[model samples]
Target: MTDHGPQPVERQLPTEESRALISLVRDLTQREIAPTAAEEEDAGHFPREVFGLLSASGLLALPYAEEFGGGDQPYEVYLQVLEELAAARLTVGLGVSVHTLACHALAGYGTKEQRRTHLPAMLGGGLLGAYCLSEPAAGSDAAALRTRATRVGDTWTIEGTKAWTTHGGIADFYTVLARTGGEGPHGITAFLVPGDAPGLTAAPPERKMGMKGSPTAQLHFDGVEVADARRLGDEGQGFAIALSALDSGRLGIAACAVGVAQAALDQALSFTQERRQFGHPVADFQGLRFMLADMATQIEAGRALYLAAARLRDTGRPFAKQAAMAKLFCSDAAMRVTTDAVQLMGGYGYTADFPAERYMREAKALQIVEGTNQIQRMVVARHLAGPGGAP
Candidate 1:
């Protein structure tokens, strides 16, 4: 009777089935997503067809139960798929990640009836979801959210604004966290609010420096009514549910960061080999080669971090801290790698012709979202000082 921490019980590294799935997904992403990604991103249009492809491919629901028409794969495998998608088009990868985050509330804490009600559409092609945790004043301090969900005659009336909702206006539903009691984290409660629920209005999309294809907007809940049945978990479990979902969501961001870093590295490698300077290829320079080596090392280390965290999650271990570490380390590495990648390309990297500039923009957003890197450091530090944790 040996104890294995969050490693998946049935995990195997890149099995034949897994490899085949990866190959198919990679081909589809590269062919279908990469070609038009720049244009779509530039135009700020949602890649709606890409979502359809992902849903049809059984990828949008990879981390869910097989009973719900999901892939039911381990987080380890699912993250690799996320990395592949991100390497091709980060916007699509991010949308998938956000959708996964929204599903976490229903999947982890919802009643059986709630699961049956919401899981299918979420896992299906026709619907997308948004997570409502951050408020105008509460980004990292999610517990400080001011949104109120008051119980009145068996119905909950929600009133407050949720800021920075990915897929805000476009989502079919939102997993909302509101203050059901007093102040602090304990007063919070989670609910499922339909997009068309009366008094729920989404503001116009914010103009972001990057990840423009995946819109971010504020959700205004002005006396929006929801049935008591829409509650997720216990009355005060919203904060808990949000944290748990973020632990999983952090890993998704880590995978996407790794994908962005890998894309930058691959582009840098190709450009350095072909771009001639000083009577030879730029890659021939020992100084440039060393930088490339560093980039490769960072990418591999970041991948390893996320894989370890994913393994922890798959085996049902306490992975919140590790997931934070992975997200923090990978996003920072991505920022560094992509910046260096842009430098390595000399001039062309800065241009929109290559994907390097887009990678740079996309990398910065990951560092800020899913809990900022500063917040991630705080989580890791807490874990280090606690009983049986990292130091």
Candidate 2:
């Protein structure tokens, strides 16, 4: 029953270069950070030191162009790095993903001059970013955002509260989406609001059930002034920029989901083998062995789905639908696989003695972030139907 046949495709090593980077990341995660991840989680401490190590390694901006000191790696390569880091610690993996998402708004839409101005500190490290799109009254219905930005002279004054900002107070910069015209997505504009901008205040961190180490808070912008030069893309292009960035951001979250599931699966496998039940190793039993098999199968499917989307993106095709599919399927798979991992561990999984419970909690957040899975389904469905088609 414990047949280790054909080693599932998900566990296979990547190409030489990818394998090298993966190995390096895995070693860094396991050696430098894993030991402290649990304790930090317990104490609700975010790993600033870990972020410094990642920044020093030039991993903070791996997918950007090399001209800006970025690694210029492919999404495929970058995703694996995320997976490894996440397997060791969800907080670091998610922080990096959110930071990357925060940067995407500008990287994808900013002018050459804007890129020149911001890419250096963003890609060179020491500065982190956050994406601000959601508001108190608008979430999944992002187009309904009521935050307003009025142009006065060469500066624009923004007044709004951005809810659920990943790096709300801690980020060096924020990519904020605000209404510049009438209602709806077409009226929105995007801006690069400095963290210390006038009237920008971070609300106290929200008390979440998991991922306590990755802070989530709201940004209160009371007449936060930003130069017109700081605007990203042309006026009214905010929705397009936001959607495009989310297409890539969803893939990052998918990678994180896979990583979380993988960690849970690995821990369960190791524990079942070493954790005696009845007589011989519990892994020797057929019933529990089937559970392991299911976990492996689901994880492989989830990875394949995201990789397919990533490849589609790298090829410059219309990959929005595929990205949504990956995000939805992989996140659901993570929620299921991690839950099963916890179940397979029986009582210990329910306790802090094991990481399975933590994995379960972490997996849940992935479903909600980067556009909730419900939003992902809508995106996919819209693509499936032709333009002007019914929902």
Candidate 3:
């Protein structure tokens, strides 16, 4: 594996502490992640130890409150750390994002007692988590999910399957949404399910195109019981909780997309400069130079867009529209930039010997996850217009 150390990204950190944090992350990524990323990914290995290290180092808890053993960093700082991690390895970066998403319900909506009991262990106790929302039949239409949870004397029994769950089988805990009433979003409720619960099992991981190291699988819940105390919010509020979590999760996807794009651009730059043509390095040619310029511009713009949205979130502002825009724009930008990176490298880019192909494959997944790019457009449109799209 070619250890192309951390590429220089001129970050606008708010504090010296954050700058030092980034420097620390870069050092960590260079030392631990980047070196074995390709080899482990190729072998379809999930780096659970790396996640353990992150939890031990407090990287896993950056955006949450310090009262619960979290890092107490703002979204702005937390997301930049995500960007740095993603630049090293998407499996690690997006895994942290999904873990954060899994913790969202309890952090944002759980009662004080719930936080006191569960938040600290979740945030920093070396536990991995998964978010369960999408099902096999209900991907885009999440409200139509068929997962049913029946209440009986202070206990809820969940029986259904959740699909496309990242870290599905390996997660220590799962944040699950199940229908408790009639139908649609209003009938749903959220629960924190222990991974070791009886009757809860996971299917084998999906054979994916990229991020092969990250396990995506279907989770089965057959009579999995939970205490009423584990309920996240009021009855029939799970859909709202899920949507709220998605808003922040989309920003995470945007940051990861930009990170992948930056990695591709770095590969293109390195390759073009080293591989020479007739008289000079291919990077010196006008056409390839122009391509590199465009790639860099797109990456910078995507970074700025995500950071802008992160700032809004950090400041307690209505940033849903901007979050959708950032997810859509940054993911689309990642697709284009990765494709261009491959093109600039010509035949070499298409081969497995280089990381460009892997980056391109990984970029494709970002457009589809956390709501597809088309769904993002609909979200942005709904924010701009009314529910019926009337401006």
Candidate 3 stretches with Cα past 4 Å from truth are: 1-6, 389-391
lDDT, candidate 1, 201-252, per-residue tens: 9999999999989999999999999999999999999999999999999999
90 Cα displacement, candidate 3 (Å): 0.2
Which structure among the candidates has the greatest TM-score? 3
Per the 3 Å backbone cut-off, how many clashing residue pairs does candidate 1 have?
2
Instruction: Write model 2 residue lDDT over 69-105, tens digit each, in one string.
Output: 6888888788878877887888998888888888887
Between which residue pairs do clashes occur in model 3?
A: none
Number of clashing residue pairs in every model?
2, 0, 0
Off by over 4 Å in 1: 1-14, 386-391
Give the Cα lDDT of each candidate. 0.88, 0.85, 0.94
- The true-versus-predicted C-alpha distance at residue 253 of model 2, in Å, is 0.5
Q: Cα deviation in Å at residue 263, candidate 3?
A: 0.6
lDDT of 2 at 31: 78
Please name the candidate that would achieve the greatest lDDT relative to the true structure.
Answer: 3
